[model samples]
Target chain A: MIHEYLIQLLTIISIYAIAVTSLNLTMGFTGLINLGHMVFFGIGAYASALLTLNGVPWYFAMLIAGILASVLGIAIAAITARLKGDYLAMVTLGLVFIAIAVSRNWISLTRGALGLPGVPDIIRNNFYYMVLCMSIAGICIFIFYKLINSQTGRVFQAIRDDETAAAVLGKNTYFYKIISMAVSTFFAAIAGSLLVHHINFIDPTIFDLEFLVVIVTILVAGGLASIKGSVISVFALLALSEAMRFVLVSPALIGPVREMMFEVILILILLFKPKGIFGKVDV
Target chain B: MLSLNNICKSFGGVKAVDRCSFKTEENEITSLIGPNGAGKTTIFNIISGLTNPDSGTIRLLNKDITGMPAYKIAQSGISRTFQLTKVFRNVTVKDNLLIAKNTSEAEMKKMLESVYLHKPLDAIASELSYGQQRLLEIARALLKPHALLMLDEPTAGVNPRVRQELKLILKNLKKQGKTILLIEHDMDFVMDISDKVIVMNEGKVLREGKPKDIVKDKKVLEAYLGK
Candidate 1:
């Protein structure tokens, strides 16, 4: 039984490994301070959940989620492209709050706050062997890392280094940023879909600031712009949070103590290592 | 060959570039110099498509290129370095070269050596001293096959000896048949290399002439140097 739980835990962690790696691509390599990146995560989750509840096939829901997230990403890029520096960050922060509001209030499409449940699993009762689902997840994560280190990858880093310099060198940074966000959103959406499918239920509450915090923790605590750091950080955080669940064993410990512990650890990690465990030191 | 015809630009109430017309023929090193506020850099920006002219025509080999995006302008065989030494500070010198370059390995190495940044290929661009950074910018431009290269204040903050080193690189560029437009504050560098000098003051071309004539031009002296 513990072994099965461990597999489930590892599988859950594999989803985050994909999500945070993509975030690392954007925030680390592109040097875009995208605090609202969780909007993409929520978009993916809600997209898959809503589609599946409406009787769409599970695979189609995942496919549509990537497209919707990509369009949303381009829309965000269009809005934030002309704004520079801290202004861009502020615009994205506003976007995060707006996304939460929409997901909570948009009753027609998202079923509002009631949430969606009964999402059919990919293999359903035959999740015993579990070979295909986990293999696909691992392959996707591997490719995500490979792409970030390619020649196109260096161009993204160059844009972060000096935008105008990149522009003059024939790189369209607006195009690059949009593409980066889209790619990041694509993976984030996939993670969300996988999550919804695994849990068989999801709602607006699942896409809250709390989830955003965990994603950011994985990215920042793992290291800035480091793919390996992102994957490592997620597992470390999941392990820490799981350990905290048992460690904080006072039966009287009440009202989201796990969350409080996660918050405390996040503060401590950021304080001691702002660049992250494997992140480059900011100079 | 690159040409600008009747280009005019104004910032609010002030005219920055007014009815300016100039052409850089193939392979000649041209110079633009003037007193403070003469709009030399503004002309550079307009010619290179960094800023659009309110009214004008820009052509390369008589192909109209007015108001094209800056990247397209670069891809069309025109590239530039800023007056303030625009370079990627975090990236290495070789990466800086690759940023503009779309050439093979052998040509790239030759381009690097031409500007004297070849030896420090692995050094962070900013870690190279002030003069080396200037050369790095110029070297960055050379990596591309540009017909017209505009440099704004390429040697602005460099010491004299290194400025002289930059001068040799400029001469080599001239020898290689690359048309050059340079904005310089140093009178000696300007006079030594210019095939034709265009002098401006208060956003208009005050005089255009041979280097010796520009040196002796009375209005050029009075407006620029307070003589």
Candidate 2:
């Protein structure tokens, strides 16, 4: 039983690490504050669930889910291209509400609030599944590292720093922002697919504020724009949260208390460091 | 090689640039001088495509570039600096030139050296003094080959020593056959460097002539010396 719990814990950490890393591309590197990252993840989960139920291969379902999520990302980026700062944040925040409402009301597709269950496992053994997830996250981090080191990445940073100057230097920043959004959403969907496959369940509630807070807190506490910081923070925070499960607290208070703990940690970090452990620059 | 023909721009109901027309000849330093709010910088903004002229045309090599987006204009061999320099503060000095997407490492080194900003290549731009940051902006602008370079008050807030260095840099750029359109308020600096001068008032050209002619024009003195 302990072994199974360890495998499950590692699996969850792997999935959240991938999601947060993808979010880092936008929120951390590109300097966008994306409150709607969970919408893309949820979209990927539902898409994967629906496709696999219709007899699509698991990898193919994942691909389709990623594509669909990227399309949603592009849509959001195009619609909100002219907005910045608080306006951009509010628009993205609205996307989460919209996504949740769609999943709840579209009973024919998502089964409404009941959600889909018994999602097929990509690999049968828990240990192998965990390894596979870890490998995928590793590959993604490598790719992100390569990308940000390239000329393309420099332009993203330039735009993040001073958009007017970037444009004046011939960056075509609007196009790059859309590309960042699409790429970020594509990886975020992969994380969602991994989540459904590992747990064998799906529901609208999976797109919860808890997930959003967890992802953001991990990024902030880890350090903004630091890939290594993001990876390590994910593992550390997941471990911390899991450790709380054994604290002998009342079962009812566990969830709220854990959430409160994250909020407190995030606040303290913001007040003190504001840059996560590995952050070399500001968000 | 660049011309603005009857360019006009307004904010709400205030006319920032009103039917302003001027041309920057090849390899010449054309200094645009005007009192504040006389719309000199607004003209540069229009030419650089930061703010589209509400009406009228901008031409580069007589090709109508009116209302093109700033980046697209930049791609066509025009570059500009802001009145307040806009260096990417956190990134390394080398990364600033890299962001321009038009310079190799050796070229960037050469460009930085030319600007006398031969600090550590990996130094963060914000670590530089304010004058160095301004020179860094100029270095980043000239990283790529361009037919026209527009500087919006390049010496604003700069120390006199750095301002002297800037004059030399601009003179060197001119010797290499680069056309420059400058907006400056310093009469001595403007007279010393500019091949030609264009005076503006209330978004219209007050006079255009050789620098020697402009300094002696009664209307130019009246506009500058006031009333």
Candidate 3:
């Protein structure tokens, strides 16, 4: 029973590992301050859940969810690509609130605050599902690793360093920016699909600002722009957080203590390793 | 060959580049010299598609390139270096050149040698001296073959020795049949290398001629010496 529980916890960590690594492509590599990135995850979850509930095949639902998320990413990029720094961040923040509002109020689509339940499993056995998600996450990371090592990867980092210089060098920055966001959201959607199916439930709250904070903390703790750092930070932080769950304290205090502990650890890490444990680029 | 016809750009209500027109013949060096705020850099911006001209047409190799995005214009065989060196600060020096476009190992080494840059290939760009950063930018621009190379203040802040090396590099590039457009405040360097000089004052092309004639022009003298 303990083995099953540990595998389930590791599975959740693997799913979020995919999400954070995907976000790193933008936040770490491209220098996009995408606060509302989880909105794509939410979109993926709802899209997949709704389609599967309405008799769509599970694989088809996953594909549609990824496509829908990518479309939204392109739209956001189109509108926000011209805006940078705080303005772009504010726009994405506004989008996150709007997404939550839609998820909370659109009863016809999202069932409002009641949440979506009964998502179909990828594999019947929990351990097998864990293996499948790990495989998917591994592949996603591998593809991103290759992409970042190519010529296109250099341009992406170049744009992050200086957009005008990158453009002067003949890189179509606007196109690259859109492509980066689209690819990132596609993988984020896949992680979302995995999450919804694993827990068999999802809500607007699952994609809230609190969740974004967790992702940011993980990325910072790991290292911005370091793929190895991101992977290590995910496992280490998740394991730490999971171990905290076993503390022999009052259950109510556990949540607050864990939150406070993460904040303190994050502060300490920033003080010593401003770039994170493996950060090559400053966030 | 590159041609600019009546290119004009205004910021707010101030005209930065007004009716700027010129042509660059292949395999010659043309220098744009002016007093500060004479719109020399703005004209470069317009030609390179960094800033859109409110009115004008640009033709490169006789193809219309007016109002194109910077990257498209660059892809059409034009490359430029900024007055402020814009080397990618975090990446290695070699990675900086690779960011422009892929080149083989031999080409990368050749470009570094052409610019006389002896810095280790893996050194971070920001760690280089100001002159080395400038050379790094030039090295990056030379990574890919372009019909025209636009350099903005390439010698600014470099030591005298590096300046001489830069002169040699420009002369060699011109000898190789590359059209060079330059903006410089160094009169001696301008007079030494430029095949022709265009003088601008108050956002307008005040005069154009051979280097000797430009120095002799009364208006050019007054533009520099003041009334």
Which model is ahead, 2 or 3, in terms of TM-score?
A: 2
Q: Give the TM-score, chain B only, in order for the candidates.
A: 0.92, 0.96, 0.96
- How would you encode candidate 2's per-residue C-alpha lDDT over B19-112 as one tens digit per residue? 8888888889999998889998888888888898889988897777888998888888898999999998878999998887546678888888
What are the candidates' interface root-mean-square deviations? 2.0, 1.2, 1.0
Residue A281 of model 1 has an lDDT of 30
Backbone atom clashes (below 3 Å) for every candidate = 1, 2, 0
Q: Write the per-residue lDDT of candidate 3 for residues B64-140, one digit (tens) a residue.
A: 99989999999899889989888998788878988876877677888899899998888988899888998899998
Flag regions of model 3 displaced more than 4 Å. Answer: none
Across residues A1-283, which tens digit of lDDT does each residue of candidate 2 receive?
3498998998888889889989989888887789899989988888898888889999999999999999989999988887877798999999898988999999998899999988888999999999999998888888889988888788877877888999989889899899889999999999999999887889999878888988899999998778999989999998998888899468887888889889888888898888778886665
For all predictions, the C-alpha RMSD in Å is: 2.7, 1.5, 1.7
lDDT string for model 1 (B121-151, tens) is 6777768887888888887776756778888
Sorted on DockQ, highest at the top, how do the candidates line up?
2, 3, 1
The true-versus-predicted C-alpha distance at residue B19 of model 2, in Å, is 1.2
| TM-score computed on alpha carbons, candidate 1 | 0.91
Regions of candidate 1 where Cα sits further than 4 Å from its true position: A124-134, A251-273, A281-283, B102-106, B118-127, B159-161
